[model samples]
Target: MSPAQAMERSYATLKQMLREGAFAPGTRLEAIRLADELGVSMTPVRDVLHRLAGERLVEANSREGFHVPRFTEAMLRDLYEWNSALLIMAARTKRPGEEEKPIAPLWEVPAGADRIAALFARIAAAAPNHEIGDAIAAANDRLHPFRIVEQRILERVEGELEQLITRGSDQPHAIRRYHLRRMRAVPDLLRERGEA
Candidate 1:
């Protein structure tokens, strides 16, 4: 394969490993060993590693090369908070009479619902093994629509959330808490529908 293809493949492999917890957080990626394992040259592996570092999926250390980025509990909480705000923004934008309505309720009515249900089924069927890890990795790859919906919502409420965050508004914590509660309900919902 070409260097570019090699790099892309290596990057994808590393991403999957990270998502599946194979490359656990804080574990350094040994370039030569990784290259050998992936059957790619070190150059392409280096390129992919550098790219992941830039994306904050990996961290660069002068002494030890690159490692998966680690998140503290507080950092994880903040990430969830930010995500909750974004999700709310998305749901609101998709709601009727919302500005422009990037995602029409009608679109999510039939096909979207089916698609989401299928995803839930897959999630439910994932076993606690390598197969489950693969499924989770694949699920991350298929999150574009969900991410787009989130981005659309965030775009609308960006200014407000930014202002609040900048002004040290405590509302994000509350919003975050609300989202956590709602997220907890998801598993139950899926179970009720016999999807889980």
Candidate 2:
């Protein structure tokens, strides 16, 4: 593979690991180690780390290198709120002169963290503006770890997500409730993850 291909591969691999809770919060990411693991050079690994940092999926420090973000309750709450608002805004938006269509009711869209994120992205894509979709994606990347933990802690997560997907723009209240439920569970989530 070419140098750019190597970097892109490294980026995708590391990003998936970070998003899937492969690293514990605040765990330092040593580029050399990752480079060895990914069979790439240190340069590409370092570059990938910086890229993930830009997405807020990883944190970078001059002295300490890169590490997973240690999410605080407030940060988690804000992300949840931001995600909720984005979905709600998307629900209320319409493509100019485009006829309204129900959100594709793909009820078999898997389950757990990926399910929720995928469903939300689908909702965001309904908006007239592309920026909303991009913003929601960023939020989803940052929130993915939390959602993984939440799947284990929260009750009836799949049911809530199904409601959100099935009702789509017809029930903005469902979107709010879905996020609010996670927001309220932040304490328990943090405690469960030993971050509280």
Candidate 3:
């Protein structure tokens, strides 16, 4: 395989392991072992490890090599705070008046709401029996993609809003208002999901 393909495969495997709790926080990831398991060369595995380190998913230890980053309660709280803010921003950009709508129904199934619900259920069930750090890490793994998608949507909306504002259009404000409503509902959704 090409170096890029190898790197991608290695990263994917590592990421899966992290998400599944196969590699718990602070667990050292040996390059040779990972390469052998993934059927890739050390070069690609090393590159993937470096990339993961940059993303804060893995930490580079001078003496022990790369290990999964450990999470603190404060760190988890901060992550949730950031995630909530970003979701609000994204929702606001999509349809500004979404806040006025009752948030409870917004989290109903056949939508991203179900995914959130499932994630929280997983977290809740795991939290009591497992380490808090592990639960938080798993939650982060699940929530990260949703945040990424939200950011992408927010970026697109911002681009359009910019152009509309330049044209002195009133539609941008209305759109933003709707999005704010939707964004405001996010916390409620999270709460519901967490409780489920």
Model 3 lDDT tens row, 153-174: 4434334323222212343354
- Model 3 scores a TM of 0.52
**Candidate 1, lDDT over the whole model:** 0.50
Candidate 2 local lDDT, 46-70, one digit each (tens): 9899988898888999998898888
Q: Number of the top candidate by lDDT? A: 2
Best by TM-score: 2
What C-alpha lDDT, on a 0 to 100 scale, does residue 142 get in candidate 3? 47
Model 3 CA deviation exceeding 4 Å by range? 95-114, 117-196
TM-score of 2: 0.92
Q: Indicate whether candidate 1 or candidate 3 has the larger lDDT.
A: 3
Cα lDDT of candidate 3 equals: 0.52
Model 1 regions more than 4 Å off: 95-178, 181-196
Those runs of model 2 whose alpha carbons end farther than 4 Å from true positions after fitting are 96-105, 166-169
RMSD of each: 14.2, 2.0, 14.2
- Per-residue lDDT tens digits of candidate 1, residues 74-168? 44445445545553333323323432323224234343323332332332232233443343334333332232234333333233332222212
